[model samples]
Target: MQQDAVIIGGGFAGLSAAYILARARRHVTIIDSGTPRNRFAAHSHGVLALDGKSGLEILADARAQLAAYPTVTFLNGEAHAAQGTIDDFHVDVAGHEPITTRRLLLSGGIEDRLPDIPGLTERWGKTVLHCPYCHGYEIGGGPIGVLSTQPMSAHQAAVVADWGDVTLFTNGMPEPDEETLALLERRKVSLQPGTVDVIEAGTCDRLRVRLKNGRTFDVKALFVAADLHRRGTIAESLGCTLTETPAGMIIATDTVKATSVAGVYAAGDNARAFGNITLVSADGVMAGLGMHQSLMFSGHS
Candidate 1:
């Protein structure tokens, strides 16, 4: 099959891009595996006007709205490999047929690498979350715990302290410097210096954090500094340059979402220095517009 643009991934970024491109009269096909990084998340927050809606609910609403546009199609498959060049990109979807497009938008997003502790993975996006902006308000002004799994976890703890009574669980990590320690002390954030054994659901949907010392802490929520990985392998195989930053390793993109490779654009967590639901959606919109403009200038749109 052939189209004007092929968007890989079906999260907020891919859907938003498809919506915009379809509205602009472009024949766009979104290839998605239907497993967004936020699938584990119960609700999406920090999105303007839709702050506290479930991730599935928001996507369903978006899909219903985009259904009005006839130029758009959704394929529930993964784009395994992409070849060819600008104005003629060929994408291969695993277990399906290949497709050709004039341009490509990758909104593949990323996955959070949670700690090895038991129950953390199962509780991810529910009791265990990452971004304070996204899940903090829902758990506002309660006993919140931050699991220090990365070097920057102390900073995360400091940030979450603004919302509620905070506790920093070192989880075997070294103590922070005097400056960092002072900051925590000044903020009245408690410190737990031991490895976490497990996290289990407690009374009233709270989380019970069990440390190695057999001590337990009942928290309204827990924030973990999880390592993130790009959701798709196609980008790396296609020669897209990945860069490491304080936030994490992500695909490098310019102001317009153009990647290191021409004819390819990246959006969402894959391209963002800081990943958030609202920001990812906005980035997708911008990348869609940029891709559209590129196509128009080249006389393909």
Candidate 2:
């Protein structure tokens, strides 16, 4: 049986799109492996009304609400492969029958590649965070550490300074040039040229940052600019266009969330570089609209 649409990844973006399609009386199937990008975080922030709720909790509630629509079907598994053209896509699942759909949405999201530092990975989403707007208010205005992962870390430190006192640790990067140093001085962002040896849980909700030189600093929280990568190969397998961003490459899409390939769309972190809960939800909405519009008009002429 051919579905109106097959959405890969059942996170906020995919679920939001599914809701839209379901409301329109279209048959939609969502394939999700059950792991979300923000699963490591205890509570999600930046979204109105539902602030501080765990991502999983919000998703659970969403799933329950989506159950009201008979047009939506849920498949709790991964999409192993996707092939075929617009209006004739065959998606092979891990342990289920393949699905045929008129339109495809890629919302597999992205994965964060944390720096190779001890104690940091264990504290991710807690003591070690990525977004200031999401976790800064809870962290309060205290001492904060920024571990440099790429050239963008300098700008990241400057932005994080708006939340707390910031120290940019240039783990292995070369020291900033003269002009860059001047900007850091103006922003009051301190530079730690020492290579970080380890990160440890400190007293009073802080992290102990130990330098390879044996010097240490205790900070209320540590901010890191982690490298982001797309989670799966479904988009590439279908020959969708990928756009390069400072963090990584994401699926390229037009304003309506339609990708370069006809009958295909992308949403969530996989489609855009910058995202929080609200933005990805918006992506889902646009993708839903784009897919539905295409489905309605494609048969004309």
**Candidate 2 RMSD to the real structure:** 1.3
- Model 2, runs deviating above 4 Å: none
Residues 1-301, model 2: lDDT tens digits: 8999999999999999999999999999999999999999999998899999999999999999998999999999989899999899999998898899999999985788899899999899998999999999998888999998888888888899988899999999988778778888888999998899999977886899999999999999999878888876888889999999888899999998998888899999998888999999999999998888888888730
lDDT at 105, model 1: 87
Estimate every model's Cα lDDT from 0 to 1: 0.86, 0.91
Candidate 1 local Cα displacement, residue 196, angstroms: 1.0
Minimal lDDT window, size 10, model 2: 292-301
lDDT of 1 by residue, 212-240 (tens): 89999999999997877875577887788
Taking all chains together, the TM-score of candidate 1 against the true structure is 0.94
Q: What residue pairs are clashing in model 2?
A: none
